[model samples]
Target: MKTPNAACPCWSGLAYEKCCQPLHKGGEAPTPEVLMRSRYSAYKLGLVDYIMKTTHPDGPRFQADTAAWKHDIEAFSKHTHFAGLQILSASEDKVMFRATLFANSQDVSYTEISVFRQHNGHWKYFSGAHLDP
Candidate 1:
């Protein structure tokens, strides 16, 4: 996990604390793009609880086996290097982004369009469709 003064993994050109740490600590993300960025940061940091909390209750991710999902997230965070993020588009309730990473010495990137909705006034990740880049 990045320290407060470290550069944010989300590639937001800001300190981790200023960029995504607040959201990891339960602060509200202002928009879907922000939420998507923070979720990427969470994956990089192995903040499984933050990930779970930010995922909408009705989402497929939330319906998975908790222990297994947490294990997978932790393993990915520890084994892969998060390289960058690109915000392709965003609206009030949706964001499309590309995430780049290096795993087993191979660089890879993927794109997804994620849907979000307010749950008790906080934005939560509802669903996503993978996209070809």
Candidate 2:
């Protein structure tokens, strides 16, 4: 059952309505949670523009080539599914958390402590460190 409006279940721990839907629907979310969830949705949906829009300009890893990102995102989506997010700490513009990602299948997992920043009233991803499971 793949409907365009259906919420993705690849973690971020949010149902469609309470999570990425607002961002996808042209609403604003200020918290790291919202931004993170939306970013995960972006990955699932291949929304390169949304990823660019949410990414911090000042962040060290910001890449301007959206086309390249689009390709990378597509490749990632083919092998990845967001499992869930565990927020370790957060402030107005920063979030540190462990996100579990499923790849190949549920039998394989990837986890990371991702960092995010809020820029221009939106949440953007910057960098992250892999966590040991």
Candidate 3:
């Protein structure tokens, strides 16, 4: 199910208007942590443009089919719900995070040490290593 644009329940702790929606609307997210939360919301909302824009170009598995990839992500998110995110630490270009997501009729969690880089004065997600949930 698609989340309402007026308010997101993804638990970023900010109302939709103040949070991910803007990022989805082509606004720059200030931090990797913010970008990460918005990315989760993008999956929930199926905002392909936002995902493609924020994703690091150097990241592996770059696909040319953005719309198809969006559909794939949405299909998965529809079967689940975004729960919450915790930012463990952050530096100039990296962030450690733990995100709680409920999926497949069950709740699953994951930790990621995400690396980001500043390009053209904007932060873009480059890569990440999944940690034990």
Whole-model lDDT values for every prediction: 0.87, 0.66, 0.75
RMSD of 2: 3.1
> Highest TM-score, which number?
1
**What's the true lDDT of residue 92 in model 1?**
81
Task: List the lowest-lDDT window of 10 residues for candidate 3.
Answer: 1-10
TM-score of predicted model 2? 0.72
- Rank list by TM-score: 1, 3, 2
Superposed Cα deviation of residue 24, candidate 2 (Å): 1.4
lDDT tens string, model 2, 1-133? 2354455543544467666776877777777766776776777666667776776787765667768876776787667766666667776655666666778776444455567765665666777666677
Task: Give the top-scoring candidate (lDDT).
Answer: 1
Q: lDDT order of candidates, best first?
A: 1, 3, 2
Worst 10 residues of 1 by lDDT: 58-67
**Candidate 2 residue pairs that clash:** 10-82, 11-83, 54-124
